[model samples]
Target: MDHLINHPGILTAFSVIIFIMLLLDLGVFNKKSHVVSNREALIWSVVWISLAMGFSGVIYYFMGLEQFTQFQSAYWIEKALSVDNLFVFILVFGFFNVPKEHHHKVLFWGIIGALVFRAIFIFTGVELINMTYLPEMDLFGHAARINVVLSIFGIFLIVAGIKSWFAEDGDDGDKDFTKSPGARLVHRFFKVSKNYDGDKFFTIENGIKMATPLLVVVAVIEFTDLIFAVDSIPAIFAIAPDDPFILYTSNIFAILGLRALYFLLANFMYMFSRLKYGLAVILSFIGVKMLISPFFHISSPVSLLIVGGILILSVAASLLFPVKE
Candidate 1:
């Protein structure tokens, strides 16, 4: 893993491939503002999943079974976490009354921002973990000294999971973007249009540049992604704390498919009523695993199976025992 991360070529190649794919997605495949059909969303969903698995196959061939399993575990964790993001996205778009045709545009830019921010979060987190090498502080009652940063992340995740598990879904009417710090900051710095201008983020009016509501939507989505990344970045670190290559590549791939996944499942989100519980359980499991990692090392394969099983059972339960209208 250290060797892979130290190799600049591998990192550069992956980054370039991701950029090219994004360009093609935005520049070629989706050049117009139109509602993405359910069929199109479904097709793209399969394509993205196939592409991710294909990359996993490459990892298996080049990095062997262990790293491949690590990548799979991180991918599943990030993908599952992304489902929670989609629920918020639905709320944001509905709140703003963003046109259906413009959803793709907002998501496309939101994902681009996510990639940049996630990289920053990963590098910073890894560095912080590395800096906690204090030989003087022999803590945690274990043979190896406990990493304070990792411990903090584990506790945060466990607490967050518990809170999410018990938190009731709030009414959408209660959400007020104007009150959000991010929204307030954006509004203070830029002049925004009263309405959307056909998916455009900016337009010139009276010799001054003004942002459209679409820009505000993108800003809110980006801020929301940053919040989600706080949870997600640490979860991946728990899976593969030492391997930034696996951590980053898996995160990017999961995010790459998120736009398609959102559209594919948005209408059907109600059917998966138990997904939040599954995510809560997964987060708590990983948190506990991180906390006890000195005493117990969960294999990546086992982690993958446990996570996959939780997701499956949650979906099955949702469908079998749906809330009555």
Candidate 2:
């Protein structure tokens, strides 16, 4: 809270940047439904990453290396976990047989939902952490305060990581997305047409207003992001449980770039075939950090180094041992 209050300028800058970029993205570049080309996706990806990096530089200047590293660590962690979301996005679009041109619109609305839900989760989670700290006690010859919520989240992440590591490929590829809770929620509220009406989320059929598949797809995507947040949100809490500003800013930046990433890598997914392993390791490592925080502290720079190294190696390994189609 104090971190947020003290950094009003940075916050304003972040807000302005996001607002302008979103306006340019939706109002100018993507005003119409169209398939996003690889080249355009690449440029957007670089732009978003550079923006995130530049923001971290500002943090370094104003808040010191610690906050900068925290931002970097959280940004990359959210970015990495977001790859899993891309896989799910591919699945959702494919299942619905959604047109490539419509993908951007769905993802755009999905990210808008993420910006809201992530703020809620990060801010609420921080408040929960602030309230759940147990009385100070000696542990292994040192005094410490254990956070109950974080400990639970730690155990959950460890289990999630182990499940991810051993999980079979295409686990979601065969599922029925129409049965998705998001889809169900949309269905519960409105009558969904069997087909899409261009990229519009609603249309008139039989002289009655009805929802389109695009809207259902967007709903499913929103729900999907919320589910992924369970793992990612808790994972980042290990980095800066006390600072929602660092967590939320880094998170939103990572998420706002995802639509581009999805298009850029959708065809070249073999390049990230080994990424699940890296994500599993990162999740487990953060989980361990949370569990051991009461007794030992790991600095942000070290965590950043470990995470960056793992991501690099994972990409290298993926290229070297590419998945055979």
Q: lDDT of all predictions, in order shown? A: 0.85, 0.94
Tens-place lDDT digits, model 2, residues 1-325: 2365488999999999999999999999999999999999999999999999999999999888889999999999999999988999999999999999999999999999999999999999999999999999988889999999999999999999999999998999899999999999999999989978999999999998999999999999999999999999999999999999999999999999999999987988998999999999999999999999999999999999999999999999999998776
Model 1 lDDT per residue over 1-325, tens place: 4335755665677778788888889999899888999999998889888878988887787678888888899999999999988888898989889999999999999999998898899988988988874464334555655677888889999998998798786544468865656567678889977877787888888888998888888888999899899888898888888777789898999999999999987878776788888899999988988887765689888899999999999889889987555
Q: How far is candidate 2 from the true structure (C-alpha RMSD, Å)?
A: 1.1
lDDT for 21 (candidate 2) = 98
Clashes of each: 0, 0
Scanning candidate 2 in windows of ten residues, the lowest lDDT window is 1-10
Off by over 4 Å in 2: none
The collision pairs in model 2 are none
For model 1, give the 10-residue run with minimal summed lDDT: 133-142
- The C-alpha RMSD in Å for every predicted model, in order, reads 2.1, 1.1
By TM-score, the best candidate is: 2
